[model samples]
Structure formats: structure tokens, C-alpha cells
Target: MIWLLDLDNTLVGRDDAFALWAADAVARAGGSGDDLAAIVAADGGGFARKTDVARVIADRLGWEADLPAVVERFRAGILAHVRAYPGVPALLDGLRAEGDRVVVVTNGTSAQQRGKIARCALAPHVDAVVVSEEEGAAKPDPRLLEVALGRVGADGADRRDVWMVGDALHADVAAGRAAGVRTGWVSHGRDAGDGPAPDVVGRTVHDVVAAVRALAAPAGPAPARP
Candidate 1:
């Protein structure tokens, strides 16, 4: 079986990292508490584009640096705060032990996403990493999922054996459904609500891992004791 995972807020605490980074960046820029709040709001939980984020920070903080430099600073701070969620490393190891192929299919700029993946020590766990920007297609568009499957040498015929796991409903779950594969949504406390239902729903990465393990486990009862 192949597991296609989402990086931010799925395998790692990306929102936590973004909060820490944004607060520090705002303070360093001599911005007030309100400025930090505005920056965080503008970040849209890392959904907003980096260029837009940089522009907001620069304008709000009265920074003199160019957009590219501001983006670099933001990226550096975010990377510094990157850390995998608890049990993620072990989960990846367990999946590998079960002979499952893992791939990180994330939506973000190559530099930012790759930096977070490396900084969080996620690279060593997965067989391949696919960034949306690099592939020229983001999630919710089935083509990105197709690209991911191709990287793992999977095709439409193998969709049944593939699972797409992520936190976002519209992006991850929708993408999986569009690609005709099973989907697991990490609810993180919020209800999945009404839409295209997921094959499995879990509150955290560990829960999802357990679900996957069960799915991949051999069926039927044990044979007579020898």
C-alpha cells in the first residue's frame, strides 16, 4: 500500500510554528501586539501565498526590505520553528516496517515546503516528496495527486491500494476523491461536516496511522498453534 501524506498541520504542527515565527518576526520589526495579530490573520494559517504574506508584513511593519528579502526572512523563521508532530517519526517507521510506501504530497513553494520537510526530519521517512509548485499543480486538482502516484510508480489501477491523508477537507479529501482513492481526513477536533465523506476520519496523525495500520494488516484468524 502507498500512503500519500500532507506535510503541514498533518505530520507537523505547522500552525504552531507559524504562530511562533510570526510573533517573533513582528516583535523584531518593532510592531505592536495588534500588528502580530494582523500578520497571523493575514497568514490564513499558511494558506496565503508567501508573496502576499511578505507584502502584508512589510506594509504593516513598515519594513524597508524588498519583497524577496522579506519572504526569505519569513521562510527562515518558519523553518526554524519546524518540528514534526509527536509520534510522527515512529508512525513513519512503523509504516515502513509494514512494507508500505510513503510519499509527502504537499502544496507550497518548493523552497518553503522542502525547507520544512528537511528541518522536521521528514525526508528520511518518505520515499519521495512532491511539492505543488514544483509540479505546477496544487491539491483539489486531481492532477497533483496523479503526479504523486506516478512518483511512487502507481497508476489508476492501483488507486484502491492508495490512501490520501491530510487535514484539509477541500484540498486533501477532495483531491483523494477526485483521484478515485480512499481518503482520510485529520479532523483536529472540528467535524468533517457534510460533503464527500472520507473513508476514515481521525483527530490526529497518530490516529490516522493506526487506521492505516489496521487497513494494511493481514486478514483472517491465526492458524492452529504449532
Candidate 2:
């Protein structure tokens, strides 16, 4: 099987990292807890445009830093705090050991996303990494997934053997569906609501791994050519 995973808030604790950065940034700007809360709310769990979030933070905290500087600082802070979920390396290793190909397909700038992957020590585990900025296409656009497939040399593989796993409904699930691949959603303890449904739902990647393993077909003898 070919597993395409998301980077932020999926393999790593992006939300937690952002919260940590937001609190510290707000405090350094002499802002109160309410100010920090407002900034976090504006982040929209990282779905909001980063520039927009930075603008909200600057306005709320009365920061003198320009928008670009604020956004750069925010990116740096998250990179410093982000860490992969426990057992992620081992889980990925197990998948690869069983002849599965794992690729990271994320919607973000190449530098920031690759930095997180390196910081979390996930670079060696995943077979390939695809970032939106590098590919010039983001999720919900099946072309991004196609780029990933081609990167990992699985472009012509059966869609049934491909899985796009992530927390975002529209981006990940919808992208996978459009690409004709199965999807595994990491719910993070929230209901999926009315968005695109996933073939497998789990609170974490580990759960999704288990579900995928159970769903994947067992290896058998090769068919004889007539």
C-alpha cells in the first residue's frame, strides 16, 4: 500500500506547537490571556491564511513587527516547538518493513514543512515528501496528489492501494477522493461533521495504521502467466 500523510496536526502536534507560540508571543507583546485567545482563534487551527492570522495577532497585541516579520517569527516558533507523535517512527518503520510505501503530502511552504519533518526525525522514515509551494498546487486539487504519486514512482498503481491520511476534511479527504484513492481521517477527537467522509476514522495516526492494516489485502502467491 501507498500511504500519503499530512504534515501539520497529523504526524506532528502543530496545533499544540501553535498554542505554545501564541501564548509566548502574546505575553512578550504585553498582551493578556484574552489577547492570546483571540490570536489563537484567528489561526483557525492553521486553516486561516497565515498572513491574516499574523495581522490579527499584530493588531490584538499592538506589536510593532511588520506582517512578514510576524509571520516569519510565528513559523520559527512553531518549528521550534513541533514534535512528532510518540511511536511515529516505529509505526512508519513497520509499514515500510511490510513493503508499504509511505509518503508525506502536505499543503505548506517547502522550507517550513521540510523543516518540521527534519526536526521531528521523520525524513528517514517516509519514502517521499511533497509540499504545496514546491508543486505549485495545494490540496482539494487532485494534481497535488498526482504529484506525490509520481514522486514516489507509484503514479500508475491501483487507486485501491493508495491512501491519503490527514485531519483536514476538504483538503485531505476530498483530494484523495478526487485522486481516486481511499482516505483515512485522523479525527483528533472531533466529529467529522458534514464534510467529506473517510474510509477510516481514528483519533490518531496509530489507529488509522491499524485500520489500514486490517483493511489491506494479505499477500498471496503470484498468479501464473498463461
Report lDDT (CA) for all predictions: 0.87, 0.92
For candidate 1, lDDT tens digit of each residue in 22-75?
888777778899998888888887888777988889998898759899888877
The alpha-carbon lDDT assigned to residue 147 of candidate 1 equals 86
Global lDDT of model 1: 0.87
**Global lDDT of model 2:** 0.92
The alpha-carbon deviation from the true structure for residue 82 of candidate 1, after best TM-score superposition, in angstroms, is 0.6
Query: Stretches of candidate 2 above 4 Å error?
Result: 217-226
Q: Tens digit of lDDT per residue, candidate 2, span 15-115? A: 89999999988878888989988989999999899889989988998876599998998999999999999899999999999899999999988889999
TM-score of each: 0.88, 0.94
Which ten residues in a row are the worst by lDDT in model 2? 211-220
The per-prediction tally of clashing pairs is 0, 0
Model 1 stretches with alpha carbons more than 4 Å out: 193-196, 214-226
Task: After the best TM-score superposition of candidate 1, give how far the Cα of residue 220 lies from its true spot, in angstroms.
Answer: 7.3
Per TM-score, the best of the predicted structures is 2
